[model samples]
Target: MPALEHVQPLEHRSGRTNVPGAHGFLGRLRRRRAQREHEASVICFANALRGMFRDACAGIGLCQYVSVAAGITVRTPRVAEVRLGPPTSFTVELMAGQEPADFTSKDRGPRLAHTLGAHGLRVEPVAGRWVRIHLLDADPLRDGFGLPSLAVATGAESVILGRTEDATTLGHAIADPAHLGVQGQNGSGKSAFCYGLLAQLAAAPDVLVTGSDITGLLLGRAWDGTAHRAHQVVGTQDIAAHAVLLEDLVAEMDRRLETIPPRRDTIRPSPATPIVLVVLEEFPGLLRAADALPKPKRGEGIPVGDRIRTAVLRLLSEGRKAAFRVLMLAQRFEATAVGGGYARDQFALRLSFRVPADSLEMLHGADARPLGQEHANAAPGVAYLSGLGRDCERIRVPYLGEYGEYVDRVQRFGRRAES
Candidate 1:
């Protein structure tokens, strides 16, 4: 893939003049304070947006979509305001419903922005009877994105995967039991997302990392026992080797669930006990290998592939509360590879980094078959973040350096911290 120099800001906003001679000290200071307040306040709809949104919002059924607000205007929705953003992007607030979700539901939302002549869009709740509509002029990921230092990337909330197409908001990865599902065709930068994620993850204290690939190539090169790395990584095509690791994972899941306090939903990382992240590379191939083996019977030894599947399935079903999160990588998202719907649901966050039509459909939905073509051809790490429900938007995973370079940096950062 191509590397991008850090993300260049298109611009914050337009039409601000710096009066060098300004109104004297206090006057100038008051003007600056006003500027700051203006920046912080929500924007008003632009002139051009008035007509576009009026038509688009009505088309999306926002006017007709209303909630139980007793005689609420369910027939003729109005776009109350369009917050002016940068020249290319902005947000709109509609007279929606008591619950924004009612107006921005899957039935009404999925393709509203796409139909509104936007590169991407997101619908969010903004207090009562109001849902915010954000529109982007073009796909932000097409330009490619770069990662910050490990120190910056490790911060749970600020470490950006990439911003929305509009550049209005930054999306970051959450470590709180959001087991991720990453899918894309070969050479589509699926691994880029994984390794990039691992790089940021390594910075968090008490976060245990482990990864595996059938050929022992990618993870082997990136996470081998180095001066600064301490996680266990499995790199082999052998099913038996994978089986052993999976068995241990299942065992740990069982042990932890039994040991953790009853009320907690999942484990939180701390200085002592850490969050465990397991990455499965070429996961579908391994899954198929497991499914091919005959079912294990009483008094008969199970095949390594089957054993591996059992452990993986267990992790998917019951690992969250146990603090075991898995990032499954595969070229396909077929039933045989990713298990049935029940299993797939365990992955709260699903990402499709540059994938083909068939895989894209399976990962997102049938309608998404054509969605990721931009990432597959023009941009590498660009993908649709499917977990955002009806508001699923296109985002680019920031490309950290190649595996070795990233690991080296992680080590160097560790040394600096120690000193």
Candidate 2:
């Protein structure tokens, strides 16, 4: 008999096929390699940013040392997020220790940007002893993005204007009824900003939108036939009509004031008594037009210009409690243009778009004077907003799409007046 062929089992006794453990081992190796590479890349980037920040602090005379604690996070290709160790003082010889506030001074912002090879930087203090820094290698607002969906609900007291440099939504409290002063040059995206704001105001059931535009350029088609259109927008070259409109608003404010309970400080808006937003477009032109009008006969009460100025001043001074708000737009907010410094001071919210240094200072004060040229050259819709208990911030107003789209949005969200 031939030797029996060595018989081999069809399956391995271990009940395992292929290369046991090879696949899992290889997978583990690959994961370990990938994690190492990622960590190495993070270290490399962190080191690079550390060097940039080191040099920047030195140039700015900040004796405080900064450390990258949270590592590097890339928000966009051009933007990076990092957390820095709280500024701590260093002493050399007999030098006194400096405070962290010295390192975070507003005056040092531009200098810090220059030293960091960055277009812009936001230094925000976070919890504990860390400062969050958003480093921008390029302007995030150089190009316009579509407006974010409105987060405010119908009858909400706030309105979303646009976004800040860090892409945070910027909103204003309309319920509190503070006046807004908007200053920008021609073709500076002011009209677009106004349209974006008006769309939201019109959507709110407890807010009534009324506007006066001497050039008729801003207050036209979008508001013409909507029930959301309250108080028939003044959209013509008639200065007399503008004055009358403002006077009527003052009268309405007075009526609302009387309805407030003695103990309550303000009138809470309801469908029956909504907050009235008076938008004055080409505000300076309105004043100039009024000035150009012939004086009334000796017995005619007050000149149209005086009536306009007085009504505006009264509204600015007394409208907040009565739920009356003003949004005044002008090329320049000179004392003469807005009825003097006293009147200008009443604007609780001030926004300056692309304008000259003098105009920026006029709107935001001397600190803004240094940024005039920067403002003048800013991209359309870029502006500096200050007031409402917040420090001045650079923001890009929302782009509500093309003219037709904007009008459509205005009409679609418009809340009809209650019957």
Kindly give the number of clashing pairs for every candidate: 3, 0
Instruction: Give me the overall lDDT of model 1.
Output: 0.62
Give the Å shift of residue 218 in candidate 1: 4.3
- What residue runs in model 2 are displaced by over 4 Å at the alpha carbon? 1-55, 64-104, 124-134, 148-152, 228-230, 417-419
How far residue 275's Cα lies from its native spot in candidate 1, in Å, is 0.8
Candidate 1 local lDDT, 260-304, one digit each (tens): 767775655554555667778888777666567566687778765
For candidate 2, which ten residues in a row score worst on lDDT? 86-95
Cα RMSDs, all models: 11.5, 10.6
Q: Give the number of the best model, judged by TM-score.
A: 2
- Which residue pairs clash in candidate 1? 43-83, 45-82, 63-77
Q: What C-alpha lDDT values do all the predictions have? A: 0.62, 0.72
Model 2 over residues 1-419: C-alpha lDDT tens digits? 11212323223345555744434556456546766897787667666766666666666766433455776422211123433322211111211453334443557767777676666665555444444555566776887867754634544556777687768887776886578999888988888888888877767767787757776645656775666455744544566888888899999989888888888999888867877888889888888888898998899778999999999899989998888888899888999998888989999899988898888887788777657777789888999999868778788888877888677776677766556
TM-score of model 1 vs. true structure: 0.65
TM-score for all predictions?
Answer: 0.65, 0.77
